[model samples]
Target: MLSRNRAAAARSMPGEGQRSSGRAAQRLLVALLGAAVGAAVAQADEPILPIPPAPALDARKLALGQALFHDKRLSNDNTLSCASCHDLSRGGVDGRSSSIGIGGAKGPINAPTVFNSSLNFRQFWDGRAASLEEQAAGPVHNPLEMGSNWAEVLGKLSRDAPLVEQFKAAYPDGLQSRNIQDAIATFERSLTTPNARIDRYLRGDKSALSPDELRGYQLFKAFGCVACHQGVNVGGNMFQTFGVMGDYFTRRGSVTAADLGRYNVTRNDADRYAFKVPSLRNVAVTAPYFHDGSARTLNEAVDVMFKYQLGRSAAAQDKELIVKFLHTLTGEYQGRSLQQADPLVARRP
Candidate 1:
């Protein structure tokens, strides 16, 4: 009886080890599968993408462009430069409801940020300028803005021997209006602000955003803000009617010719009030929001968007969260965060 019992015990012990090994393999498989699912979920959820680093451009052209951007001689009276409206140190905006140009003239539409302008499919608020080069020529020619024609600008700039020399060095064609535009456009292209907290998160740094900020981003997508404001520049890739869900201009009233938006360019009735959706990158600092520049604060801007653009209402808490998430989109320029470089000029949300 003792010998029979010993044999049975040995057989049972062998089966027990095999059973334990099988259970361990199953657990490992489940863990791997769970990890894969989590990754898939994360990928599926994120619609926005990270801003890529500025492309490698010619150093000579970039330097020439940077000089021309800040040179007030581009303006008629030498009072305003490109930097006057699109100040790089100040989130590439003048922080006004509408940019003030030469002789205290106020622009009709808000001056969109020069930062990341290269990423945009079209240049101005109405999507009138198709390229950065075309856009650069605009302000100089505009009567209310720089108030200078290409010929006048060339005459003024030619007086500066050093600038002419630099232009010649940068372009074989020398100091022409087209070359000037190219140089300024080249510098504008370099103004892209990458390395935002949201960008890091998009690049798989899970720890990049705080809990509330992450929640805000989720709400932003859930609430359909991402429909117009996605892609590398966050919102510059497309055009959408400002008041899709509601008549925004009617509510605001006093709609001007500028408010006609893309209609001015296309002359199509359907394109009325349609504007190139402005990029939300660094929006926290570039305040007095919208093409109309009506929303004075980021919070107000979000509210207006919810009401007019989405035609929906969100809780106060959700709106607050969305604004917080927007704060994460403020990115680094020249190795410094835009917030640090220039604190938000607008009142806090």
Candidate 2:
């Protein structure tokens, strides 16, 4: 969370931007993390974990993850990466209901925003992967996604001495295959999207957001969308069947494996068609919506949610107000400076 790395790190707080270093230090952190995990397990209660301070973004891991994220070479046909589907400038999604991927395989779901995803309770449309570290490993090997084997990725990266050097500088254990994942994961954790005007307003600054956005917020709650999509990561903490007031699965038709959603992960018939309520922070940008990318516009998605879930229809003004409010959710990210700025990553040596 160094000031220089966060880019928008400055706020009204003191001691807000400092970087922690070394394997031993991180190991101490890991021990605490394990204890916290155990404590939560014992309680069987779900509490929001405080978002950790963004990890250091120096000239090492940041650079590596940045390269890996943007490098299409990670795909089998030299086609995609975490960035291909989730473009940073494009509100962290490719703006398709689903993007074309390796071997031109159409992804079964929409690419969720990478921004502030470190805050999500889980990864993917189903609440899976409990940590950002585990989530970071996903696309690298998904057959229809990047489609690259980690072993092959490791072999390719192992020959790059410069990448190895960057890894050593950023990771305490340095350059092992798993550590490469660690570096990329660490860099991704450092990627937090915050400081929206609405956040400031919610924090007590009355003038931070516009009147339209404020109206939108009210309509959001009154419509009871908050019942399923609430809490810090906004919506990632919970799961709900797609068509709750009515049968969404039956309506979807020609049901693909993707329609099974959480049921696919749990093997429970009751869980069928349940998907994680996605964070709507950047909804204005990431489009062709829904888990299956079935909705094409932000307004359309909002209308569908109202009709199917809330069992109400929004007035034109309310719909416009909500769209205005959604625009505030796009926090700024401009090709973030990485912990490492290695030429190898930039050049793909």
Candidate 3:
């Protein structure tokens, strides 16, 4: 009887061991499936893309546009040019909270950088202009901007024999307002800055980013910034409310017409405070950020995004890392680093 019992016990032990092994295998399979699902979620959530260089353009047209862009004669008082608001040497922005326009007039909104603007689906913070051509026509006639009618601008341009000759060379129809807009728009399209370190990293150059930058990028993705700020230009392709999680205007106080954002164009309450997401390319130098330019520094801008747009609190280290990642977005303009040519003028209190 004892021998029989030992034999049964030995057989049961092998069976029990087999069941245990099967359970271990099942757990392993479940873990692998979970890992795969997690990877898919991450990929779906964060899709980073590199910004390609601008396409080649006609040299004569590009030159003509650059001249027009810098020519102050476009303004009513001959005191400002496109360059006055968008300083090409300074990340394509004047580094002011609000642009100073004709007759020392202050613009209602911040001047977004012209660099890579061609990639945007629409122009302006409110997405009022459907194309760069339409956008070019805006400031020229805006009362606070260039403050000049198209007729006055054409009259001024027609007087310059060299400019007229160049215009004729560039456009078959010559220097009409439409042609001028076309030329300026074409030049603005050429103002793209490529070869950013972050772009290189996206293009599979692992060494392009440092350890901190890589971690910062991961954090940027993890924190859900990429939800709005994604794609080639990184945020220009869409519009989002300024404060998704909180009332930015109420917090800041003294809301202006500019704060209305896309509401001015749509006249819909739902569109209130909706603004075209500005591209993050060269954002480090385009300080005094947002439609109002309330955030003074990159760090402050990140903090505001977390508090208002993201509706979350982030550790100081995370914010610093995110800022470091943003710095990597600065790129080269015609083989040279795109940086502010001068220190930003102090904003008025």
Question: Who wins the TM-score comparison?
Answer: 1
* By lDDT: ranked, best first: 1, 3, 2
- TM-score for each model: 0.86, 0.76, 0.85
lDDT by residue for model 3 (210-273), tens: 9999999999999999999998888899999999999998999999998999999999999999
Q: Report clash pairs, candidate 2.
A: 58-339, 59-339, 59-340, 60-339, 60-340, 62-339
lDDT of 2 by residue, 119-218 (tens): 7778888767777667767788888887887777777777888877777787787766566666666667766766555555554466867888888877
Give one digit per residue, the lDDT tens place, for model 1 in 121-163. Answer: 9999999999999998999989899999988888988888998
Q: Give the residue spans of candidate 2 off by over 4 A.
A: 1-59, 334-349
Clashing pairs in 3: none
The CA-based lDDT of model 2 is what? Answer: 0.69
Q: Compare candidates 1 and 3 on lDDT and give the better one.
A: 1
- Residue pairs of candidate 1 with colliding backbone atoms: none
Is candidate 2 or 3 superior in lDDT?
3
Score residue 89 of candidate 2 by CA lDDT.
Answer: 67
In model 3, state the lDDT of residue 47.
67
Q: Which ten residues in a row have the lowest lDDT in candidate 2?
A: 340-349
